[model samples]
Target: MVFAASPLHADTSSTAGGAIEIKNLAKRYGSVRAVDDVSLVVRPGEFLALLGPSGSGKTSILMSIAGFELPDSGSISIDGRDVTYLPANQRNLGMVFQKYTLFPHLSVRDNVAFGLKMRGVAKAERLRLAEQALATVRLEGYGDRMPAQLSGGQQQRVALARAIVYRPKVLLMDEPLSALDKNLREEMQLEIKRLQSQLGITVVFVTHDQGEALTMADRVAILSQGRIQQLDEPKALYERPRTRFVAGFIGETNFMPVEVQSLLPGGALVQLPGGANPTEVRAEGLVGNIVARGDAVGALRPEQITLADPDDPAALRAVVNGVIYGGSTVLCVAQLTDGTELRARLPDPSRVNVMAGDCVGLRWPVEALRVYGADAGAEVAAS
Candidate 1:
């Protein structure tokens, strides 16, 4: 049975499940700065992901928003109200963690209704709300089952139901799906997104997984060394990364050293090696300010590269080192005469038929190349 829509969901005001603003947030542990002057705003009812490796300060920022970690400096405001010093329980936010954290002794319904009980909700009303929450998570009939009796996925659903049972203004998830297996994790990713859309609740998710961040978030904030490297939509981040770290981290890319012959209006003309005549290509999507005669790195996605005949005039000569057969595509690893390795992703091994130790030519579209200064720093921005 589906639960009727609550009146809370009908409130479309910006203050209802509203925007989250963090301004110049800073945190430190001894001499190490966990969060370094980080600032960003999460739009109302929008799903935002904090993505970065360990020591990148993603978790510190999230903890501060949840009121678990007090910032050494900076402020956090929710819907324009200063909540930086508010207690975690008083913030009226919901949270889910990596572990399900279900009580083994309690039945699923009671587990989900526990928070309501603590808030002085009466018995019958809380139970009714708990069952409705279960139905929302597709676990209506599992309410009587003990936590230990349910599978990992079902237990996680119960945890989700519990978190949303009180209809919080904002939901914070910290790698909540990390404990589940790959298939189950993917299924829950869609489940969480569906629930969030249905309830019109804002979400702030923290994960180190790039694909998860890309697939689930409306906008992703990528952190590096306690700073936001970039905050953009998945398509923008993938197509035009502002930093070398972002380009390498977001997806598979091939980086080659090149000499910048000259700078164009929005791009650069670079000279590539390994051809009879030096192949000078006009590379667009320049990452940073580049100058003539300077050394830079050119980046191309594996799928952007094509294999050609060795004698092709416009191709760079390379020798195939190995081939990896993926389900729908094959990856060819090749090396230029200068020993720079490049990977080309081609469709269908049967169609291409290139073998290991074979001499080949690599070519890509001029617009597909993104050139970056060898030591370029990230251009930080928020949306």
Candidate 2:
């Protein structure tokens, strides 16, 4: 679970890595723009994740950076030097793909030394470095085993060892944990974070999984339709998503339609779709031009909502549709009179066990709601 950082193999000291600058990067197919005019800067020693669903162009941008896909336009640079058209083999970078691409005939040590071998490293030195790299990945004894003789996780560790043995300036990983099971994926997430921190290598990780991005990256860029909708640290992106797309994609939330009565100095006052009470929500992050008086959506996470006390008169009425018992929490699905579905996650499932068709009250703090411009997918029950 810890990297074996021997002085000669991996740089375990706290060091800043090379910065990467991408400018107006664009790539296109016959009729579709794979990477629209996009630009970003990855800070030295930062774990930057390019996150989005399929067709979001995250992979395209990554491939272009790796020199696997030639961009139609734009330039990429590392530490102020241009490598826009550099050959992939000459980039001096480490790469880990989703699939385990280890050579079946090569032992773990040989596979780890393959990159060095290509660079014409003497056989004995490469083998020594390979042994050190395996130790760095906590696979010290597995170096003599063939790739086909290792488990998926062990093979991944070998791949990681191979990538780091030559000391590349930057590390690029494309969904490297996608093939692992849930437990392994989580374990690798922590492992990767530790290794990256230890090596001080600039990492650009491409992943469609939001949890993975939030868990591993120092900064996350959420791309959609070949454009970045939001770029911020994990907590900031989750708590104050600037756009509806980001709010919905990063986590599950109930979005209620509301009519903006007025924009206040600190926030906005809006009336819920079917409620008479006008609630105030902090709208400091909304663009000035976009916070006009009209329709908007209120974003609230399910865990923020709770069952109301029997005596609370202002509680909203909801009919329980179903209750699902998770190990540590419970999810209650309910429906309002106007057909709006709401979900409340309770810490204890048996707190107030109301079976299907039972009417109950729901309560949530007004301050917990976040307001956004209403769009087509602004349904309250959307996850």
Worst 10 residues of 1 by lDDT: 1-10
Q: For every model shown, what is its TM-score relative to the native structure?
A: 0.93, 0.91
Mind giving the per-residue lDDT tens digits that candidate 2 earns over 207-281? 999999999999999888787787899999898877777788988888767678888888777776555367666
lDDT score, candidate 1, position 188: 91
Best-performing candidate as measured by lDDT: 1
Model 2 scores worst on lDDT over the 10 consecutive residues at 1-10
Clashes of each: 0, 0
Per-residue lDDT tens digits for candidate 1, residues 38-112, read: 889999899999999998999999899888899999999988889998878777688888888888899999999
Query: Candidate 2 lDDT (Cα, whole model)?
Result: 0.79
Quality of model 1 by C-alpha lDDT: 0.84
lDDT of each: 0.84, 0.79
Identify the runs in model 1 with alpha carbons over 4 angstroms from their true place: 1-16, 275-284, 378-383
